[model samples]
Target: MQQTVVEHMDRVAEDVVALTLRATAGDLAPWDPGAHIDLSLPNWLDRQYSLCGDPAERDAYRVAVRYDPLSRGGSEYVHRFLRPGRALGVSLPRNHFPLVPAPRYLFLAGGIGITPLLPMMRAAAAAGAPATLVYVGPSPATMPFADDLLRSYGDRVRIVETGRHGRPDLHALAATLPADALVYCCGPATMLAAAEAAFPAERLHAERFQPVARTFGPDTAFEAVCARSGDTVTVPADESLLDALALSGRPLPAGCREGICGSCEITVLDGTPEHRDDIGAPEGRMFPCVSRAVSPRLVLDL
Candidate 1:
């Protein structure tokens, strides 16, 4: 983790503040369009926020945070207590929603979900890629960078403030896109579900803040064997694999232990893993925080 100072704090929208952070000693880590950093605050609180600033600028980085009334405490603390010049610990940037090469692109951003997609839009335009961004918010006043998006991108950008009319029909929008256009979306559950039903699985890519409903078999006792050290730990049915590993003196780095963040991921050397993470991890990788092995004995790359 690197110590960073909040260089600037400006109100970008209603109940939203954009923070500019600079590393205390040197340059911050380089980041891509869809990358995010783990923000560690005082009072033993930590949360992940997307990087929304220019990727080339290493001296500083920016992140926009929305005050959530139903927050687990991170967003509330950030809006209520944090200020300019305060210190914050930031982890190296990590990207799970990377942009894949496509002939054409379509972006769907809803409310605060636009944070990561902002840079993506800019990057796509700069690369001369044919792209369009459909941005939706509660109202113009509640959206960050709405005016700039209109003035800067012209016809390529579409803003729909739901206060003036009904929400954007994601199903209808998906029907109008080119056949080969890759649809990248980040938004609320309703919007995501609409896109999922309208677009093919291979053509639609989405980033979810909350885990989708998934069904798995009953949790049972399983052995997590460390391939390198030859140490074995038995994970109980009721307990999480992350906690079991820590008790066995092999704690791994974790974020959002509910399986939303991909921080506690470990490679499966030999086992069938019951993948329960939100980020659809490919085969051979599993999140120990909320995932388990289907096989009785599992070997991990520890």
Candidate 2:
């Protein structure tokens, strides 16, 4: 945990604010592109924002936040209460959407989703790698970092404003990419889905801010058996698996409870899991925060 003071807060775009924070004590920890920090806000709400600033700068960290009208209090708090000189708590950086080495890069950003890709573009340019960015937003005012990206990258950056010009031909864009080119997308679920459908799954990397809608059969009570402790806890339909485990004295590590962050992941010793997170397939593990059991009983490693 680090205590930081907001050095500056400015509206970078319509309903989007950029916050610059400086460590109150020691120097901030180093973070790479695509990394995000968990901003602990009032009322125990934690929101994750991508680090958009240069990785070489260790003195301060920069994060851009977009205000959601249907916010669950996180964005509203930042927009309303947070100001210059305000103190806030933040967790160390974590990267699940890491940029891997590739021959070329194609970044597709939508609205404020450009936050994570901004640093990635900088890193790619600094390394002399071939990269292109296609930023899409409803209008010019809603698109953050548009001018800066255009000024820096010139012809390498493309803007697709829905209000001025209709939606870009994503399929056409995806078809033109090279075989070795890596496609990274961060945006709304619809845009991410379009990118996923347009490109190969192996080549497409995405980070989602919201979880996808899932259809589950009626919520039924189930039992989670702990392998190590040999304890069994009944998870009610109204309760999440994470809450049930925590009530049983075994709390799993969790970040965003909305299933955006893969923090409350737990190993499944046996039984299939009904995946509900936006992060996609859980491999062999399950995120207890939003995922629930499909079988009558689930065996977890705990």
Instruction: State each model's CA lDDT, in order.
Output: 0.88, 0.89
lDDT of 1 by residue, 1-302 (tens): 88899999989889999999998988988889999888888868778888999998998889999999998999998899998989999988988988887878999999888998899888888888899999898898998988888888999999898888778887787778899799899888988898898888899889888888878888999999999999999999998889999999998878788787787888999988888888878788989999888898789998
When summed lDDT is taken over every stretch of 10 residues in candidate 2, the lowest stretch is 275-284
What's the lDDT for candidate 2?
A: 0.89
Question: Candidate 2 lDDT, tens digit per residue, 168-193?
Answer: 78899877888889999999888988
TM for candidate 1 is 0.96
